[model samples]
Target: MAGDRALLRQALSTGEETDGRVEFKERLSREVHLSEARFESLAAQLRHRVLSGDGEATYVVGVTDEGHVAGIKPDAFSESMDVLNLIADEAGAHLDAVETWGTKDGIVGVATVKDGGTLEIATDHLIVGTAGHVDHGKSTLVGSLVTGRPDDGEGGMRSYLDVKPHEIERGLSADLSYGVYGFDDAGPVRVDKPDRKSDRATVVESADRVVSFVDTVGHEPWLSTTIRGLLGQKLDYGLLTVAADDGPTETTREHLGVLLATDLPTIVAITKTDLVSAAETDAVQRDVERLLRQAGRSPLSIARHGTDAALDEIGDGVVPIVRTSAITMDGLSTLDTLFEQLPKTAAAGGEFRMYIDRTYRITGVGPVASGTIESGTVAAGDSLLVGPVQEGTFEEAEVRSIEMHYHRVDRAEAGRIVGIALKGIEETDLERGMALVPKSADPTPTRRFKAEVMVLNHPTRIHTGYEPVVHLETVSEAARFEPLDGQLLPGDSGETEIEFKFNPYLIEPGQQFVFREGQSKGVGTVTQCIE
Candidate 1:
């Protein structure tokens, strides 16, 4: 079943005409002897392949020149990737994706590469979501880390997120905020004027790799809001914070459950370490490790092990722990390195679909819809549909223009968050939970769905007539729960029918959701959508 039994050379030749965008290599290595001209020729061939595929190319590794499914050793496969990556760079491209499979001989891999030179530079952009209890320094840490500005022992640095007057006065983040910073050839590019839209856009434009932060709410009452940020956006990682002075709390565990439940790789940042003694910090770190362990995660101390270990092990059940302080700026560089080295892992394949997380009206630009591309890509002049706003119907719309980080771009791909100016919809018509999709998708909004769910935490048993707000993608609305078994208890897994008490949404089977009300909380996967 390795590489799904790749076709033989003869079989491949029986197909349609070759476009030269696909290549096969038994193995490759820098150690191989080749003259400068020969190497340049090879690189040129790779470049041509990338250009032919319109900024993407495919390479099947561990296959012979004749296309036989001959696998190679694991080490050989890695060396081949290294050489291929090098060649791609030389060809002004990058090895964007590499998937492998085990075989009798050894291993087989398929690499999907990127075209380095492009107006839409999203190949290396990463979206990070932050979650923690209030006063845990989530926003403050982000502000300091991106702007390279230390806090003034108050909420001064938090202003980078454009905190609201009430938020500033209360010294608590009540909604999702964002911060942008990135790295280039030389080093990290700090955003000095994050409050200014143009300055943020400039940073995104200049950086070779960009890291966008989606800072979520942490107060207990705003758990739903926090879940929206973590699950709504196509995030690459979750930065769960724990203040050194306070260590872990109930809300921290709640947030962590949501983060891990969504299968998002996480990094624990122990903030405000400067205010605590080393002994205190150690104790807090132990608490965090224990908490992570209880959540079935291996806590990795980046301070002890290193960056390589974190990058290589994080997705494989290991969660890195970093001690950070907004004031002292400790452990910030480690985060920067981790972020820089971390690969973009969001899903990039499928029909274009973006959930509307925010909508705003610009004085001159008219209506702008903003959200991360969940799948596929969108470009200016593309005809799309925005929907479920009226009687489960989708309205036709046109993407007049697109903006990323305040910078104008012709198009944006999956995993990149941007604002798109629409031609056929009013700003008031757009709702946070609505979606933009290719007209061909013909999406349907649902008022009810059947799901397999677990009571993550609940004070009592749940039966019919239980009303809770369901958070699926960007759709958050109160829904009534009906248990097929008549009743369900805390920690119990069961089948339930949930119907949106209000407006319908574009709900499809296999979509994960979280619901909460009062002190009850749970997560589930939709098995069927009933409109």
Candidate 2:
């Protein structure tokens, strides 16, 4: 990642030759080179590179003799990797990881051959998404927690995450905004003006353990945005807020259903407890318990049983309830402790994938794609395919740089939200609902897929010709749903074929989706795909 790059490089040096730790091979011969001296010679060079790197080396396949990136055939590249694998093994090393992307007519990849053995990168940070009714103090509670400052009860602290002018005037968040703080070896590390990009970046870099809040809107009209937060982002847990004075609203229950439907571990936070008497707070807790039980989930009291038990039971169909007051900062530390100790349930593995949630152009950096890495790791200089344009195709692009929050970083792993500055694409081409994937992934966009769908709520029944907008990852589009059988009523699970009414998207089997139309809502899983 340092200095110049050749697909992958721990550090490339100045001049025609590299730092001796990086190697470029168009293709490695699979002939009897292993038993011959040719293998020993190549293995000896790899060993020297490892020694030079202190037991780490980088190998770039499909490079031309002209020093250009002319990708090789897939078979040749595989053989090259096989040969490199043998060399690494002979040199007392292993191919720890490989990152692949599309080239002009073929594909290129970087193999991180290492001798130190694989180390597990723990997801020290937990991303908690907030959901509730408007004016339940979702934003204000997050603002106070991130700044370590108690709200003045006049809703002054809401500015920490709420950005839009209209949202400020209306005292409600209208879209998704993120605020993060961290815990270090000492304790919690709070920052000022966390709404700013730079401050949030500082938190991610400085803290040993970090917690991010995806503050979502609670208004009925902005329900799509809330669903986007719950469905699009790689969220670890859900925080549903219910004011003690007004326990749970219709919107609160709807949000809870969607959160639990996504199978995200949820925690109910009784907010504004100071506004009501102790008895009233107790009544709100009971109401929350009833709602959880109605939803077929158990409730655990953090105050009664403690944070350790809440963490243990929250994943096992248990919804932990915590009481909080932005006015007094009550119960903030309990949530903080729980967050600090919570292991990131999300992980980074498999093929590198990211969905573009936001896009922007830097003053001189051109277009950048921002989103959380959904599956695998990505590095600067990695080639990726982005899009499923109206034509249902993808365009090749190269990652020029990577940045987390606002601080420029060399690489990013899964579950880490980042903005990737790109080359070979215009800013106008990037949009939400699009995705970034490795070229070798060979992902295809599909218009029709058979899914196992269940109607959560509906007026009558779902028959052929029923249309609902399906929210798959970041791709949201209306699709025609035809029951494979006769018809489906509420709570009826059946096979259905869905054809995108508009643009085709990069979707596959086993992916989950949430669809909604008017008063009808449901959750489904793609069982099979058809182009």
Candidate 3:
């Protein structure tokens, strides 16, 4: 059933305690004939409900205030929605979306109303990326958080996130995986069916705020994949997991450096607390605090000062540390609270730009490009350019549809990971690192650029003609580096010229990139682009 009538009725019911955010109406057409004073009162009530819901509210059509689902005719439902929209307008809100279901008697639907200015102000969405050493409970912790289920203490919860058959067989993640959970006014929306995209999308649609987890590979050999997950997306925060028993390792340090190098505010979760003694937990906490300070970050223990203080200073160089146990469910509630209140860091203003991280094709939908919207907004039917194809050319395309976490949406703003069905190009033409922009922007691709590089590690001096693989915004290509200030040694910083060995990309100034060759690794920021 697309929309089960029974489920819809239960979800829309206020139960014993009346919900101020949810209203019910058999039909709104009859309300328009009310006297001016009565209409004014109704409008005032709707406005109050929207404000109480933090700029949004839900209305159940074809239902009564007493919680009875007395469905209405299709024609009446259409007129009711129109009247509801006018009433919402009177309350300074607008109809955002609606979902309907068919019943024996008539139809029932839910209308999502939002304040007119909310789209321009702030959105209730956030993204967090997981990074840590292998078998450090990164996936287990995320699985438990998103699914609201405890691990069996032997990698049971991990199965919820490690979707690939090979990954489950190896008991390790070999590539990037994603999980999502959200918070409504009541609390966290526990997604039992974590494997289903539809279930995840339901959580996104029903919640007041949502958090998406980009689970990255943690093994030493897959360091490149971890780096890509951390730097490629528009993540608002980082969740670095450390098993309490094992504490931090060399790989943990590497992952932490990448998290901090990208200036992502991080939350350190010391997992498996149930397996360690109280004294041992204290020791690990001290070690974590020392490492964070060594990396120039202030560590705030959420267990002591609480999530309120941590959430207030999030993204301001302060890292929150929480002791957690997937098996025992320790510190999970605090984590949920912090995520529920964390403000969105990425603003939705500026020119639209998205780096295609993946692509797909549907039998009847044509080509689809999926990636995080780095900035600006995109709507269905908008004309955009997709590429930097082999020749660095962007081809014209129209956005046939846009989806976020499998939920179809008319528009998507910055900080959202979306899959867009595009017209006017073949699926084979799209590749990772291609940029999608407005056709009028006249975007140009570049093969060479100037950047300020900081050598984090190197066996020897980096001289001109040094070729290393550069990872920049989903594009990993071999690039030749020439230090403008002569040869550079480890721990040194200098302006360098870089040229890609293969195809050009839509590189821009101020973009960050990481380059590495075996044991050597360096980070840089693009200062100038030469087409």
Candidate 4:
């Protein structure tokens, strides 16, 4: 009975959270009236409560367009069976009984319950809030939320789990860190403690329903790190935090520009808001908004509170404004609510592949590929296909174990950064853009691919078939571009028939990629292998 409700809500919701209060108002009707009598009946029978937590209960309601109640909506039909199974299996016969009826002009379905049940459901709503800017207190905000104290340590802050060759060359040091956190309507979701002051990393717990945050370093050299933070994962939304008192600096503007260009559902956090009074905060907020508008966004929502109010606003779909002060512990709670407010993490369960961001061989460990698990899971002892080395060679490797944060785990899924130990593979066999996947399902490999390339940051416009360095699957190599059509100007998209002078095999078709000029880079995806 309990499991039934969890499945119902999980299936129907487009990755959002309820206030935990099961109040039903007819969507088609204008007046916000609660059907207390029906709700009580559903609530009394314990049919609606799927998974109940401490101070949290998620309810599922099926209704029609005409302000009536139906047992379950038509679209929710197939999944409701799972809910019924759960109801029968976990809650017993009495609790398993579900009531279906028609009301007014439409039909409504209700599941009500009051009880204790532990059901692990995958998240429909997941978001990543990147903490950028050097020593900009990115880790401090993480510490305050996780440890309930200000973060004062430094070094070994892992910002991204990537599989790009350059990213691998950037290397993982004490300074590279990945932090994930989960939050809900009330407050911070429980997170494991960071290993040490310097190794501050957080993992958004699996049980988390709505929001997950990824904190990154704000140092200058980590621009690629920042790009990895953004491009490494397909995010539903982004939270860009800038210190209010410091004003808009150059790096701040550059990062801000990139985020805006991505058109990601974005929210801006003006940190240190507590340092300024109401008036000062307002002034800074205006300045930030102006800068953002200059970047082509309408004024975004700004929050200046020590409470979770900002987070609530974020959860409620307010954009552009969030204020937090780790120093005063103000607005710390808002971070979660703000995170919850964004759109849900897209269902990314298709291909189980990742670009290798970093690779190294410990004297005894063999070859280790450290990167975020982009789409699928990698398990211990699973044969991994490592491929498309710049030299066009493919190699088979074995996954010894997977690590999330610093803790070893048997497997890792999409949305988490993980490290895998590869046996029978050498460091030279891998590059930053190389990909790793399960051995059974092979990847199509080709050195030359037909793709659509856009020239961004190039010294001049790129004509069709021009030569450029191709960055794909963690490796970057020189390739000849045979444009499918005309010249590609900056910011314009064009299809090209590209053929490498020498074919580098091991990459598949349909893989998205980036092209790097001496210092500038543009984005593209593999369409067809030229052969």
TM-score of each: 0.76, 0.77, 0.77, 0.60
Candidate 3: residue 29 lDDT (0-100) = 73
Q: For residues 356-443, what per-residue lDDT tens digits would candidate 2 score against the true structure? A: 8889875324488987889988976799999886587899998866776655555778887778988788889888989899977788
Per-residue lDDT for 120-195 in model 1, tens only? 5546889999999988989889999898878888867887784688987787788888889999989999988777
Residues 1-531 of candidate 4 have per-residue lDDT tens digits of 123344444424422234232433222111211144533343333333334233323334454333234543332432342333333234432121223334344334443333433222234436464645654455556556555554333312222232235643543222344444555555555444554312322233343453445555466665655655565555566767777667667667656655655555666767776656877777777877888767667654543343344344432333457677776767766555555454555455866787777777533234678765667666666887887654555678877545554444446667655668676777777767677877887677665567765565666677755676664544546677666656777777888876655555555566666665554556676777755
RMSD, each candidate, Å?
A: 18.0, 10.1, 9.7, 18.2
* TM-score of model number 1: 0.76
Report the backbone clash tally of model 2: 0
Better of 3 and 4 by TM-score: 3
lDDT of 4: 0.54
Off by over 4 Å in 3: 1-122
- Runs of candidate 1 with Cα error greater than 4 angstroms are 1-119
Worst 10 residues of 1 by lDDT: 8-17
Error of 1 at 118 (Å): 11
**RMSD from true fold, candidate 4:** 18.2
Instruction: Show model 4 residue runs off by greater than 4 Å.
Output: 1-131, 151-175, 183-193, 197-214, 234-236, 275-280, 294-296, 302-319, 340-344, 361-365, 450-460, 463-486, 497-529
Local accuracy of candidate 3 as per-residue lDDT tens digits, 29-123: 74562457766777787788787788888788787777687888866775676566657767788666567876787877877788772132125
TM-score of 3: 0.77
